[model samples]
Target: MPNDHYEAEQSVISGPKGKVRADSIQFFKFDGKSEVDPQKLAKDLEQLRAAVRQVPDVDPDERDRAVAALLAAQDAATEGDEVKVRANLKRVGKWVLNVAESIGVGVAIAVLRQVVASG
Candidate 1:
């Protein structure tokens, strides 16, 4: 693992010892700048927000929750907070994955993934 070139857009901890309890882990940040294009991510997040709004099966409350997640994702992207953006996007995706194809949500999320991948 080369710290200088490591782009950990996602991470997972597994195995028997991976059971992380609250206050059991210590985290630290490396002073590395992100290569992701914040503007591109923000644009796709906006599209995702629109797509979420058009989900016919989602009730008003659910739609609102999804949109809130998108907005948080957008904000995080603008600030180059990749982890937060992905977490928020996951929240939105979980809220509407079943109806993804019914609207443009699937496409929107895919585009966002591309933006992050190439950023």
Candidate 2:
């Protein structure tokens, strides 16, 4: 299909053993910068509305329970990620402090040796 500013094309792909499949993919690329297309936006909204309507309906209490379960699961996942991040940070911090302290002690010892030799 061809329009004033947008064009669409299709292609067919053949799988292994000569199985052919037709793909109905539409590519809408603008030739130049343009304003929003109201028609396309309306069509997209309608499609979304239809999809939402297809979802199963639950009673209010059941819906609340489902929402609570989802929130609990999300909180658990977040906490798990946070725990892992903190553990890794703590491990890295410990290694860094160890390295820093070793360097500090070496520098102190070298300074003391220099002072004693000068005296």
Candidate 3:
């Protein structure tokens, strides 16, 4: 396994008169392409699915949709099609972020954002 780290910084201005400002900085760890293993990827995706399912205050329908997206991503990975795998993963990441944000799971949302953006 290859351990690679990346950092991202973001700033936002909102609210009336644009007086409110928010900033966020995050560090993400990426799995190296050369080190990718299908079995490991499947396991990791399952873990992420479980985490999403465990989030509190999440709509059941939303959670089911997110899990379905993850399963599709896993199927894509099993086929060893890099393009399809990336596409499905991107879909899964987006759904994950949506669910996370709905339930106020800030950490998961930030992590998913980094994963989706980095890819």
Candidate 4:
């Protein structure tokens, strides 16, 4: 077994008229032989949920869908299923981009990359 790592980079948009924006990136690496950490995944999902909830002037339905996607991603991650986790994360990324666009926020492009190697 080796180490498995996942990384995501996104643009965060804020400020009046969405004039301010910054790149937000995170990395998560874990021992492939061990179980994935559900708590860490849950915490990350919580933060994303909160961010969606904070966005103003977004359609209620869209917001709800985005939150649901995050929840699904969390569940997939908890199961230690890399395939499902990746799929759900892609779904969440799309929803986030839609939410950002609807709220007049700067465009957000989420790029997810994974690396696995035997140690």
Q: Least accurate stretch of 10 residues (summed lDDT) in model 1? A: 22-31
CA lDDT of every candidate: 0.59, 0.31, 0.58, 0.51
User: Model 1, 1-119: lDDT tens per residue?
Assistant: 23334344343354444554443332212124433456665876676677778877867887998899889978987786766766676665454544444455443455344333333
The local distance difference test score of model 3 is 0.58
Model 2 per-residue lDDT tens digits across residues 1-104: 13334332322333343454433332222223323232332333233323323335545454344334323322432343322222222222122223324444
Instruction: Judging by lDDT, tell me the better candidate of 1 and 2.
Output: 1
Judging by TM-score against the true structure, name the best candidate: 1
Candidate achieving the largest lDDT: 1
Q: Compute the lDDT of residue 119 as modeled in candidate 1.
A: 30
TM-score-best of 3 and 4? 3
Per-residue lDDT tens digits of candidate 4, residues 6-106? 44443234333456432433434334643345456555665666778887777887777777877776676666555555556565435565544454422
Per-residue error for 70 in candidate 1, Å, reads 0.3
> What is the overall TM-score of model 4 with all chains considered together?
0.46
**Model 3 lDDT per residue over 35-78, tens place:** 45655556666667777888677678877777887777667656
TM-score of each: 0.54, 0.22, 0.49, 0.46
Off by over 4 Å in 1: 1-11, 14-36, 94-119
Sort the predicted structures by lDDT, highest score first: 1, 3, 4, 2
- Worst lDDT window (10 residues) for model 2? 85-94
TM-score of 2: 0.22
**Residue pairs with backbone atoms closer than 3 Å in model 1 (clashes):** none
